[model samples]
Target: MSNHSSSTISAFGYEIIRDHILSSVLGKHENEVLYWAGKELARKFPCRTIEELVAFFVDASWGMLELIKETKDGRTFQLTNDPALMQIGYRSFRLEAGFIAEQIQQIMGYLTECYDEKREKQQLITFTVKWDVKERIQNTIPNE
Candidate 1:
């Protein structure tokens, strides 16, 4: 057994590691990117408010939203495998803009993991979509 201590994790250390991982591996910050991404997707997917967004999460059986708080600039939502770990086990998201579409747009990523936790062996799923919503719709004009 290793003697490394997990108790001394500083807020700054967590921020540093989290920021690095999100920006490098995930291509987004947990808040600035992942959180907002979920929010955006939720908007696109058609949930009215944060509560509905959370309910959609529950419907998908993606843990339960233990805590959800937002501001004009962004939002923070958390889900957990164990309801007791609302403090530790929950995952979060954040974004700059306030709109239903933001949450809807980013929600697919969260949904992507819907089948993951129960699998004995997991597989990578690629997420691709219309990054430019307006442009894609504009480009697809049927001409006979």
Candidate 2:
């Protein structure tokens, strides 16, 4: 095996690589691409319950995920962690926002959207994921 495969990267190391790619490689389109990438990831790792989705975030080392509030239309999630070694910004969480949006869209069978707000002082990020009940996802294939 290659030395790269033999060595394990720490969470911080992973964050650094992620940040570099988002900022340097993706550049201006980082947020947009990351959001789509996250949606694609959600498609791959579909969750049946909110608990499973939350657990996935922790396992992925994204941060501590918590459901702060929920309404008939949507839910809000709070993700917080120390600012040491990670870039706290809008782009940083777009992937997560998209992931949550897609997961909810699939589970609720509605058109969902997600946006995030960053509290720099608190080192906290809040994602508001919502969908209009009236805008349901149409089934493309008929049940056979």
Candidate 3:
């Protein structure tokens, strides 16, 4: 028999699965779980630079990722919908937040953290990622 199970799904099917996971399986824990899932996804697809990371977002259907600001210790990224983000609320973007945090942390060799700011009216999400320079040279991961 053919592998029908591996067939491509329509956008409707995609939304159905997303909604189910958000409203049923994940529910209140949706933010936390999805964030960690994003981090794990980053590990699977590590990017060496900010440009590659932004491109990865576009390729992954997460919308357009743009670097809006950069500072000594960190940067701010704005994720705006190229078309639309399906109106999934701010919590949905935590996944992207976590993904970005891990990617930057890995690139900069620092312990990083990220949080998102929602602009519901504009359908934009901003992620502020920051890391301390002191933490970079510290004993973060110990020998096992």
| Model 1: CA > 4 A from native | 1-24, 49-51, 66-80, 83-144
Clashing residue pair totals per candidate (backbone < 3 A): 24, 0, 0
lDDT of 1 by residue, 1-144 (tens): 655443334545555554455557665344455545654554455654557766765554344543344443333443443332222323332321222334433432222111111211222111122233332222121222
| 2 against 3, candidate with superior lDDT | 2
Better lDDT candidate (1, 2): 2
How do the residues 30-139 of candidate 3 rate in per-residue lDDT, one tens digit apiece?
A: 88998898888888888889999999987776778999999999899988764334454623777888899988988888989899988877778889999978887344
Clash count, candidate 2: 0
Worst 10 residues of 3 by lDDT: 82-91
- TM-score for candidate 2, residues paired by index: 0.84
Error of 3 at 120 (Å): 1.1
Local distance difference test, candidate 1: 0.37
lDDT of candidate 2 at residue 66, scale 0 to 100: 94
How far in Å is the alpha carbon of 60 misplaced in model 3?
0.5
Q: Give the TM-score of candidate 1.
A: 0.31
Given candidate 3, what's the lDDT at residue 45?
88
